[model samples]
Target: MSKALDHDPDHWPRRLVAVTPVLPMLPILIVCALVLVGLVDGSGVTWVPLLATAPALAATTGGPRGVLCVGLLSAVLGVSLGIRGDAADGVLAVALASLLVVTLACAATSALRGRRERVLAAVRSVAEAAQQALLQPIPATVGPFQVAVRYSAAAAEARIGGDLYALVSTPHGVRLIVGDVRGKGLPAVGTAALVLGVFREAAHDEPDLLDVVARIERSLARNLGTDDFVTAVVAGYPRDGQLEVVNCGHAPPLLVRDSVVVPVEPVRPAPPLGLRTLSGETPDLQVLPFADGDQLLLYTDGVTEARNHDREFYPLAEGLARHTGDEPVDTVTALHGELLAHVGGRLHDDAALLLLRMPARTEAPAPREPSGTVRVESCSP
Candidate 1:
C-alpha cells in the first residue's frame, strides 16, 4: 500500500494549460455574436471586421498551432470578404498579424506544458522510490513454511499504510503478525513500526504466544497516544504441525484446505492492544491443526469491509471459496484481483494478505529389529 502526497500548489503551470484551451475562445464568441447581429439588422457587411478575432482566439485557447490554423482560415475568409467589400491593405495587415500572434502563443504554451510534465515525472519518481524503501517485500520462505504476502493501500501511489504483516523465524519458533492501526499517514506508520519491532523482539524472547501479545500491548501503550490502538493477530508455529494463534480484536484468519474456506475459531478474542485494560481476562491462545498442504490466510479489515457501488459489503468468504486452490501465490493473486474488482478499482483502506503454507510432512520410518544380538549368536555358532 502507498500513501499519496499532499496536493502541490506548484501545479499552476499545468492548470494554466488546462484552462488555456477555453479562454481564447471567449473573444471570438462575442465578436461572432456581434457579426450575426449586424447581418440580421440589414447593415452593410460590417460583420467582416469580426473575422480578425478568430486567430487570436484560437491561439489563446488551442495554443500556437491552433492559432496558426485559425489564422490561415480567417485570412482566407478575410481576403474573400475584402474582395467583396473592396477593403484596403490595412485590414489585410491586421489579419496577418493575428495569425502570427496565435502561432507564437501556441508555441509558448506547448513549451510550458513540456516543462511541467517533466517536473511531474521527477516528483513521481521520487515518490515511487520512497514507497519502495518503506515497503520492502517479504521473502517467499520464512521459518519452516512457504510464505506469500500481498498488500494494497487504497491510495494507489502509496506502497504501505496502517495495515502491516510480518513473519520471522525466532529461536522460540516461527512467529507471524498481522495488524491494522486506527489511522493513516506518518502517525499510523509510526505505530505499525513500533508494534512490529516489539513483536519481532518479543517473539524470540517470549515462549508463549500470549506473552508475545502482552509484550506488544505494553509496547504500544507506552508509545501510542491515548486513543490509538491496533487490532492484531499473532501466531506461532512450533516444530509441530499445530499453530498457536492469539487474536486481539483482529479479523479471524481463514484456513483453506482442499479449496474449502474455514474461519479459525478464536479461543477468546481480547480487545485491541492499547485497549487491553478494558477487558477483564487475557486472550487465550487457540490451537489449530496446520497439516501440510493447508494454508492460513491473514488479512486486515480493509479486505472484509470493502463495499461495492451499491453499498453492499463484499462477501470475502464466498470470494475465497471461489478462488482457493493448491498454489498459495496464485490463490492470493486471484483474491487480490477480485477484491479490486469488487470495489470497482482501488480500495478505500489498506488491505493486506499473508498466506502461510506448510509442506506435507514425510512419514516416519518403522522401528528396526534387534539384529546385533542375532548376528553375535550366529557368529558364535
Candidate 2:
C-alpha cells in the first residue's frame, strides 16, 4: 500500500518530471497547429523544425548558453529543412533573422546568470562570517548557571540576524544580553554586533549592570545609523544570589521558580538604546532574588509574536507552563521545538531564547580533624 501511494502519479515532483519530456515538444506542436491553420505553406517547414529545438534548448542550457545552443541548433535545422523544401528568399531571410535574435538573447541571459551567481555568493559569505563573529556560542554551562540558547533568522538560509544573545563569565559574575535590533539584514546585524561587542567589553569593566547597558547604547549611537536602535535586556549575576537586570524597551525576562513562571517586572524601562536623545532617563536596575534551582528565561519578540494558522499569537507562558520543568536545557529545547511547531515549522521573524538555571546548592560536608594529631585515643573502638 505504501509503495503504491509512493508511486502515485499525483505526487507533485513526479508529475512535474513527467511533464518534462513534453515541454521540449510544445513548440513543435504549436508550429504544427499554426501550419494546419494555413499560417504559411511549405516555406514554414524550416521554421517549424527550428521551433521544435526551442524546448530542448531551454531545458538543457540555462541563460545565455541554453539560448545560444537552441538558436544555433534551430538555425542549422532551419537551413537543412529550407534546402530540402526549395524555400524562397523571404523564407530564408526570416529564418536567418530569427536565429540571430535567439543567439543574442541567449548570450545576454547567460551573462546575467553569471553576474547574479557571483553577487549571491559574496552575500552568502558575508552573512556566514557575520554570524560567526556576532553570534558567539553560548556554552551549555556558565559559572553557577546551566544555560541553553536557541536563535533563528527569519530569512531562510541565514542562521543569524538582527536578534542577538551573548553569555560570558567576567570578573564581576555571569553576564548576558538578549537583544533585537530594530531592523533586518546587514544593517541590523551590524548594529547587533556593535551592541554585543560593547556589552561584552563593558560587562567586565563596569560593576553595575546599568553601566554595561549604557556602554552598549553609547557604542550603538556612535556607530549605527541615525534611525537605528536596539531593544535589549542586559543582566548580571553578582555572586550574591541576586540577578541585576536593565530593560531597554525589550520584553521583561521570566523567572521560573518551582515550575511556575513569573515575569521580572522592569522598575523603569528607558527607550531603546539609539533613542537616548528622545528619552534621557536611564533604565533603573531591578534586583531579583534568584535562589538555587531557579531559572531565568530571556527572549526576543519573535517568541511572543509567532502566530498559528488561526492567526492567534503563541502563548509562550502557557507553553512554558505545559512543557518546562526543573531542567534548564530540556525546558529550552522543548519550548524551542514547540515554538517551531506552533508557527508551522517556519518563523516570520528572527526568534531567540536564553535559559539560565541556578542548580540547587549542596551543603558542605563537616571539616575533617587534623589527621596527624587528632587521634583521640581509641575511646569507642
Candidate 3:
C-alpha cells in the first residue's frame, strides 16, 4: 500500500483538497431550494426569481464546459418558472441574459488557469534538466570497490544542491571527496561546482593526497568569499589493504572493518575549505587499513545533524552497524531509507551518503602483520 501511494506522486489528501462538487449539480440543488422557498411562501413576489443564482454558482465551481451546461439549465429552468409563476416575458429574458454574461466570464477564467499550468510545467522540466546535468549519475563499480551514492535535496522543486561527492581512479589510487557548502540555493550550488571541478582535476594530477587537498583549497580561496566555505572529507585507496583520508572540518568518515564501524576523526581538525585563515591549520591526513571485506562510508554534516521532532540526533554509527554489510550498494540503500524514516520523510537540509566496499582478492592476500594501527568502533557518539 505504501509503495503504491509513493509511486503515485499525488496522494489522496492532496486530491481531496483540490476537489470540487460537480458544477452542473450545484445548479440542480439551487433550483430545488428556490422551488421549496416558493412553495412555502406563495406571494406576488415569486421565489422563482431566485433561479438566477444557478448560473453564477455554476460559473464559480466549473470550467468552460460546466459553465455552458449550467447556463443552459438555468435558462430552461428560468423560462419554466416564469410560466409556472404567471410572470412577464421581460423578467425571464433579463435573468437569462445576466447568467450568460457570468458564464462567459467564468469560461475565460478557466482558460487563463490552463495556460498558467502549462507554463509552470515547462519551467519544472527545465529545472530538472539542469539538475541532472549538475549531478551526473555515478556507476555501480569504480576500480577495485563497489560504490553507491544517495543524495536528497532539501528544495524539492530545484532538485539540485551543494552536497557534493566524486570518485576517480587515479595513478595514486581511487580518490573520493564528499562535501557540503555553507549556505543553500543557487549560491550553494555555485560553490559545489567549484569544489567538484577542482577536486576532479586535482585527483588525477596530484600524486600526494595533501597536494590534492591543497589544489582544492587554492581554487576555493580564489573563487569564494570569506563567508563561503565547504566542509569535506577526501579519501583514497592508494593500494590494497590501505586507505588514506583527509578531513576538512567535516563529519568524520565511518570505517567498517572486520564487522565493526568506527568514525575516523582527524587528529587535528582544520577549518573548512575557504576559511583556513581563521583556523591557521591544514587538514590532517589519516591512513587506515582497507583490507578485503572492509568498507568506508563518507558523508556530509547533513547526515549526522538530521534530527527528529523530539530534537534527537540520528545515531549514524548505530544505523551504519545495523544496516551495513559486504555490498556497498545494498548497505547505502538501506541506510538512506532508514535515514528518511528517522527524519519523518523529508530532511530539512540536504543529505548525502557514499559507501565503498573493497572486494576480496582472487588468491586471498596472505595474512601479514598489520603495518598501522586501525581504530575499531561499534558505539554511538
Candidate 4:
C-alpha cells in the first residue's frame, strides 16, 4: 500500500492532531496530586482551590465535553478536600467559590476562542478575495508562448505578499510585469495595486512599452510616499522573435536559450520607481531576439536572497538550468519546489517567478505562385 500523505494541505491540522493524539486529562492528574498533598497536611485546605489549574489547562486542549468533565472532576475533588481537612465553614465556602469561578472562566475562554476562530476564517476569506483582486491570475498560455507563475508570501497568515505579477495580451502583444514593493503588508499591497492598475491601463493604451512604464511612475509619484518605491521588470512581446524589456532597479531577468541561462542585466540601471527624482533618469528599454524554444524568467530578489541554514543564498540561474525545459508550467513548478526545499520549506520573504517560453516552430508552408498567368508560356503546350 502507498504511504499516506501527511502534507496534503487540506488535512494539515488534522494530521497534527492525529500524530500527537494525547489525552487531554492531564489536568485531572495534577488536581489529584494537589488534593492528596493538601490532605496530608493537617487542616491545610487552602491548596484545594488551586485545583482551578485543572479547568484552565483543560480549556486549552479539550473540547467542551472534555472541559466539562475536567471541571466536574476538579469540583468534586476540591469539595472532598475541604471535608477531609475538617476545614472551617468560611474556608470551605471560599474553596467552593474559587472552583466555581475557575469553571466559569474556562467556559468563557472556550467561547472566546471559538469566536476568534470564526472571525479568523472570515478574515481569511477576505484576504483570498483581496489577493485575487490584486494579482489577477496569469493564463497557462499567452500569444506564442507557454506561461507559468509561482508566488509565495513570507507571512503565512497573510496568504498574500507585496510581490505582484500580471500578464495581459494586448494590441501591443503579450505584456507582463513582476515587481516587489519596498515594504510589507497592506501598505505594500496598496502600492502594488497602484502599479498594476496603472500598468494594465497603460499597457493597453500605450503602444510604446516605455510609455506604459512612465504612466506607472507618474501614478506612484502621485500616491506613494517619498521613501517608497517599487522594483519592477516590465516586458512585452510585440512580435514573433522579439522581446521588449524595461528594468526599474529590480533583479536581472534570466533568459534561457538552448538550455544555457544568462541574466539580462539592465544596460543602464535606473533608480526604482517613485525615486526618479534621485536619479533623474528614465529607465532604458531593452530589445532582444526571443527566438523559438527560448524562455525568459522574471523574478523578484526574494529568489536570490533566500538563504539556507548555513546562510548561503539559493543559486537561481543554476537551479533554473537544472529544472526548466520545454514546458513552462513543469519548469516553474519544479523550480519552485526546489526553491522551497532550499529554504527548508518556508521562505522568509515574498518570492515570485514568471516563466515564458516560446514554443518550438512547426514546418513552414511552401511559397505560393503569383496570381497572374505567365505572359510567354514555354514552347509547346
Candidate that would win on TM-score: 4
lDDT of 3 by residue, 1-381 (tens): 001112112243346555654545767788777766664564312554466567566655556676677667756665666666667777756766776776677677756766777798898798677665556566666778777777767666656777888888888889999999999989999889888889988999999999999999988989999889999999988887889999998998898888898889899978999888766888878988888788889887777888878978889899999988766666765776666666666677787888888878763333322111100010000
lDDT: which candidate is best? 4
Pairs that clash in candidate 3: none
Model 4, position 198: C-alpha lDDT score: 93
Model 4 lowest lDDT segment of ten: 372-381
Please give me the total number of clashing residue pairs in predicted model 2.
2
> Per-residue CA lDDT of candidate 1, range 85-162, in tens?
555667656655664565466557655766776798887687566445444456666665766667766654444578
**Candidate 2, which segments miss by more than 4 Å at Cα?**
1-93, 96-100, 157-160, 220-228, 276-280, 325-334, 340-346, 359-381
Candidate 1 — which residues are off by over 4 angstroms?
1-134, 278-281, 362-381
**Could you tell which candidate, 1 or 4, scores higher by TM-score?**
4
What value of lDDT does candidate 4 attain over all alpha carbons?
0.79
List model 4 lDDT by residue over 191-210, tens digit each: 98989999999999999999
RMSD in order of candidates: 15.6, 13.9, 8.4, 13.5
State the TM-score for model 1. Answer: 0.67
Better of 1 and 3 by TM-score: 3
TM-score for predicted model 2 compared with the true structure: 0.71
Q: Whole-model lDDT for model 1 versus the true structure?
A: 0.69
User: Which candidate, 1 or 2, would have the higher TM-score against the true structure?
Assistant: 2
